[model samples]
Target chain A: MRREGSAFQGVGAVFIKELSDNISSVRMLMLELLIVLTAMAALYEAIIALRQNTAEDPFLLLRLFTVSQAPLPSFVAVLGFLIPLMAIGLGFDLINSEHNRRTLSRILAQPIYRDALLLGKYLAGLATIAISLTALWLLVIGLGLIFLGVPPGGEEIARSLAFLVIAIFYAGVWLSLAMLLSIVFRSPATAALVALGIWLFLTVLWPMLAPAFAQMISPPDPRYAALGLDTPDTAIWTQLLQRFSPNDLFGEAMLAVLSPTTRTLGPVFLDQLRGAVMGAPLPFGESVMIAWPQTVGLIACTIVLFVAGYILFQRQEVRA
Target chain B: MSDQKPEGGAASPDVVIAARDLTKRYGKTSVVDAINFDIAKGEVFGLLGPNGAGKTTTILMMLGLTEISAGRVSVLGFDPARSPLQVKRRVGYLPDAVGFYDHLTAVENLAYAAKLMGLSMAERSQRIVAALSRVRLLDVANKRVATFSRGMRQRLGLAEVIVKRAEIAILDEPTSGLDPQATLEFLDLIRELKAEGVSVLLSSHMLDQVQRVCDRVALFRTGKIVMMGSVAELAVQVLGAGFVVEVEADGAGIARRLAAIPGVGNVETLAEDRFRMTADRDVRPDAARAVVAANGALRRLSVDEPSLEAIYAHYFQASQSGGVRDAA
Candidate 1:
């Protein structure tokens, strides 16, 4: 069908409006402040924790993210817990509020197609996430400089930026999932609760359940049990099942980006480790390759959830 | 009461909107069952019906918001279902309950609408001012719409409609839940739009409301137009050459005595001292003689046709007797 305007004509308008709304909203402010305060505390603890591991450091800036003091998790772990909340907070009311306030029909009556509206909302959400993540990152870097009294090398900065991008991509999956729920459920409370339930299941319950599930699928070999050793096959299947969780993909990508000495994320046999020097850093490009599939998984999940939301929203009746 | 094609359209007064056997079905139920009509340029056409009479559904179909299950609707020479963008860009809609971004200022809301309409920054500011001033909202342009009253929101909605500069404005129950003054203002705004040659299609359940502004109207019942024409045409069709006489003759039994007359058919008593009588034949003289002969001094009398409500009731009864289920 021939359309009047370009497919993306109204996307820019919606993006600008939504971005301003997100940034100026009190909810985002509270969430950002929480993330920033936790980041500052975690970075401060990391500074004290990583003081002695200065010899032969290639990606030293990333140490700020992985190192932690007692009673406080690492910066990466804090982000893993906080980013989903921030993303869900931003998205849980995005579409349902339009319905509740009865503005959806008025907006849809405009000259643009449904494609622009959904795309615009998603892009605005991604932009907000990027801005908040970038600010938090710069704060961490600045804190590292003050406490450690040394600027990070270029390689460290590059690796840290890559980790930041991967983190944002991971958050996008939850954001898209939250938005899909928002479109599906008319009540914001229900949407937020369902999204949080899924997140909790995937992050906390899925890891414990995956082993039992994988054992049912591929149980340990009885012949290997006769040799007084459990088979690697069970571990391999459990790891494979665990990888389906976005949290695991995020953790794997974070490890590859922050610690170059880490070679493989999945099950690795001793034969594959031949001639590999322990604690030797891989090149920057190879580190990206190692983490590429995890990043792609996060991105693919985001796209799948967004497409589902878009289709449902488009098929809905505008009368309401 | 005559529904002549309205005048003052600078553009061609040809059909701006046309429907042919347009039907909308949900599963097996047809909500808008095979409706057909044409709205000319600058014409103020009314879709007059009570609630659940398919007025809103027909408007949705015409605007291409609802899918047409069968047949077609053409708005400005384009099939709305096929090219809805083109149709919507030129059509402005005021829904039953208008909504706006309450957190945004009035100007901000209109500016957003202008941006979606492809206006530039310079054009947006210029048109927003012009549109708001036209709707008498320029003084409160910078105020947040949350603080605005319902009438103000409705006016802002009209401003947004005008800022788009659409050729057609479709209003669904625009004056619902408004005070009489606000309703009059809303009607005046519609008249201004009509004067500017915008094809106006509004739906209402109020006969007087439609008769005041609409050039022509279609009375709908159960998703069908039971009778469609100007107010005069409907009155003539239902009450052909009938004279309804209201007589103020002081008596306790004027209504019964009027019904006992030779030609009077529909007798409604305004009071014990007043009676309203309608008849196919001329019964004014006989009615006056009967009143005076009843030893009741005739204080006042007037011979006029029945109101549109009475005509509607007649058509409603006609449709019910024809085995159409409760088409009122």
Candidate 2:
């Protein structure tokens, strides 16, 4: 039978409530603190390195995210590592906590379908990540201006903003993954542990293991190895394997956006670089075009994960 | 209480909820087998049964929170499965062990429900305060629910229903886990709801408490309703001998004289001065008159009223003995 009325009738209410709950939650606060401190430490190290170099590059502002001192990573690298953690923290308990608290049935009894609650919660998680990422982005820019004593060019500003948006999408991927786990596991602790385990495997193990796995599947050509050239088939296979991890997609997308000279994220043939200027930076639009596939990949991963969670939650019984 | 009950047939306008052949099944096992009942407007109907007796399953089916394997249920004239939002808009449900967000204040929690109900900001605050006051939770409106007791949380749940201004309230084991005083207080709130013309359908395993507030009750056994009607009617049906009258008196041959009264049967002497008998009707006046005429000193005379507890026990005992006495 057809259900009457819009399923989104209570979306606004659920969204507002979840947004406030996420922002005020103690776990969220701790995660936010960790992200800010680590990002600032990286940013400080980047500024020190940039100050010592006195580089005259036109994209010097963009270097704030990529430059690093010894024993410390760059601002973008720190964010790439921490964004997923924050997203998981925000969503690992999103649905199961309601079940544990015995409130799911009561809430579902309201004049709204499950669609509204799940959608609202996912949107709220995305919004929370967006707000924090934007704030952190602006803080970095402000610090760059004060410490470097140079105004950022319009392209640099545009590129960093693009990076900020990509970072939020990156967070959405992990948030959706965590929410899916929350729906699958009844215990919040179990969901959290499993989400963290997947995050570790994708971010740490996958990148290192992708090349070995790809080579095993498609051995490198002897002719290419003897000529001191990368094999085309193995490179393509490795890139495909790495693309399965959201971390790889997000990292590649950020790299393309923040470093305009980057033309491709995969292994390059000498012929592909022929006739290109040795160090000329691509235009802002061209950089975006280069990152477009990865950005879309991040968004697609988020949607697929969220849809999986939605289906599972819809079929779940409301009884505690 | 509305004495005019809408018997099994097409629903009357007075009926706020009607279930016809309502059934719920999991795989091959039917949890609720073709049970039918009606809740009239401004009346308190009870679904009484032990745990796992399909009471909760029936409640869930009515709210459309779970899939109905077969048959249909209408709440507020809308089929719950087809138009759940419409039915839910007018019906408030408090699931067993009703829960609230402990971190949120009572007002904040109720406000969320109010927003879900689409109440405007101005009306939301007004209704929230009014609901809290009605449930006697106004004093703790700003206190986090974690600091509140279980009874307070249950009251807060009731307040949420009040905020919705629902036409019908469905409570599943609302009084469970509450102290005797709290249970009484909660029942009073339910009575107040009935007084305000809100229909209530409450399910519970605690028979005595349900007997106190329910206008009519359906006794659920296994997946079917074994017996149903007002407490008095069920007593007459299950306990065919009817009312149990007790007399504390002093006289010669009082038991034999009490047995001679019209509509009285099976008089037995408990003590030299006490007697108990089964009567089809209230034989108190007749017994008193007979005792006075027989020159016996009448000290006390009372009847053991028909209680859901007795009816539930008698019906279950009879069924357990392999005598399936069908009384509905």
Candidate 3:
């Protein structure tokens, strides 16, 4: 007799187990510490820069993410580098280690379906990333309040909150990617390295290569451009190609949400800005709209990676 | 020869597990090929085989962990492939190598299992405590599994199977890696489960242990069950109805002389004062007389039925000879 099994029958149980396991693991603790230290260091430097600035930037709270000191990078840039590491740290050994420890078969023998187990693990990882980002966000706010002495308005809080949400989404893409690598690779170390390799390629090398690739794909026409080898089409194509990298999307989304004065992610002509004030802050809705596509793109990438991993895992034979 | 299907009315076999020509093939080679057996309610069934004889493969297929290439298996009237949750819900599987989250305490590990079983918070805690105590691990319940010895881990596994209160328990190599005392204790636990009417299907290479616990056993070899019967039935089938008498005395050339006696099938010198003789009838009188005539004092004489060990050796030797004949 086939019972009508609930898809989410044991999700809560597995979710609790996964969350507790991640929370207690020394490995997770170390990764969280690394992210927090880097984020706080970046924020401290931003506060220092804000103290010396004399310009009355209407979006000063938002500038905390984009502005940096001499030795440190911006909070957004630091997170762009470290968020993937945190995700990979939590995810690289998720499945294979169960096999290594000889627990997979035993765990699967439980009444729960495999769907619950995978969903629970993924949700736990996303929750871990969410919690860390929330702490970092609150830390930045606390530092800003201490240094600037004036409480941030609702608009600043909303923008920072949006940036945090996007950061979590960006981290989820890498987390799911790392989880997929973990499923594919039997060795945990290999999984971690491969996930990191992909992250490094996207974050560090893609920006430099994207422009060149874009130029080649949509190279200038000599009939339109005499002196300028790169056309306006090339710039637009470069922006589109760069968006392929999760890091690029993450950086652009943060910039749009944190720097409300940022009117467009792509090239903007002076004619389009003729009537616009030079440094006017965009309304919260406009800022969200500006980052909307990037946020959706990051989320879509996470979902796609997770679905591939799930399909692959479902096909795999459960042997320990 | 008789599979004893439960559908045979009047017998009321109450089959908990029934497999018909079950097979598992990885590519071209079949690992568990066309094997069939039935484990009835409260019966302890043993799958005795050498390493890699496909005992684990069969168990995996039964649990729906591995896809079966051909044939069908029904557990508790449910097809594992189609209704794995229903099968898993009713069956308790103790894997060959029992493992747990080493970081968690014994209580936490059992609690996790209870949660997956969907026990309420109150029932979960009560069962965890009862299960730990049942396995005699209550004293170490709070200790991390990392600190547990191999025997303790095995006990925990047994407790897990017990706590589930399932209709059928599939224990794969349950006694492996444990000390002799622990294995004894583990077997005792299996007996207790059987007393409670839990059908057990245990796979092990240890013939003696299986002989003691299993009501029926299937001798597995090279991806197939070569012989299936109760231990007594196998003993009779292989060696025939006879008693083997060991004459504890070494009479020089006495072994051959004893073979001449009527109803005596064979004789072998056991040690410096011992000769073993096989007979189809009561031959102890003749054995004693033969030993005395050979000028050896028959210090001791003991009669025993053919053992499972002897039966296994005989079957393997017979199969090897058959193979040679077919090849020639």
Give lDDT tens digits, candidate 2, residues B1-328.
Answer: 1112334433788888888898988999998999988888899999988899999888887787889998877777676777778778888989899889899999999999989988899999999999999999899899999999889889999998999999999999999999999999999999999999999998999889888999999988889987888888888899886688999887787888888888876888888899999987888899998888888999999988877777778878878776544432
Which residue segments of model 1 deviate by more than 4 Å?
Answer: A2-4, A52-56, A221-230, B1-13, B239-306, B312-328
Candidate 2 per-residue lDDT, tens place, A1-320, comes to 45678989999899999999889989889998999999999999898888899758898889999987879988888898999999999999999998999999999999999999999999999999999999998999999899998999999999999998899899999999999999999999999999999999999999999999999999999999999977899999999999999998988998899998898888887899999997789999999999999999999999999999999998898887
Each model's RMSD to truth, in Å? Answer: 5.7, 3.7, 4.6
TM-score to native of every candidate shown? 0.88, 0.95, 0.89
User: How many pairs of residues collide in each model?
Assistant: 0, 0, 5
The predicted structure with the larger DockQ, 1 or 3, is 3
Docking class of 2: medium
Q: Candidate 1, residue A165: CA error in Å?
A: 1.7
Minimum summed lDDT over a 10-residue window in model 2 chain A is located at A1-10
Q: Can you write out model 1's per-residue Cα lDDT over B1-328, one digit (the tens) per residue?
A: 1112223211344889888888888899888889888889999999988799889888888777778998777787766676677778899888878888889999998898888888899998998999899888999999998998878888888887898888999988888878888888888999999999999998998777788899889998888877787776777678773667888888656677778888677788776677888776657788888887777788888887546777777877876787755453
Which pairs clash inside model 3? B248-B273, B249-B273, B249-B274, B250-B273, B250-B274
Cα distance off (Å), candidate 3, residue B255 = 14
- Residue-wise lDDT of candidate 3 within B1-328, one digit each (tens)? 1222224322235877888889999889999999988888999999998899999999989998888899988887777787788888889998988889999999888888878987889988877788788789999999999999888998898777777888999999998888899889889989989999999999998888888899999999989998998876787678774578877766576777688789887778776667777776668888778878888767787888656788898888888999999999
lDDT of 1 by residue, A1-320 (tens): 45455778799999999999999999999999999999788888888877866675656678889987888989998898889989998999889988887777778778888788888888899899999999888988988888877788888899989988998998899999999999999999999999999989998999999999988988889998999865788888998899999999998999998988889887788899999998899988889999999999999999999989998987777776
lDDT of 3 at A218: 91
Candidate 3 chain A, run of 10 with poorest lDDT: A1-10
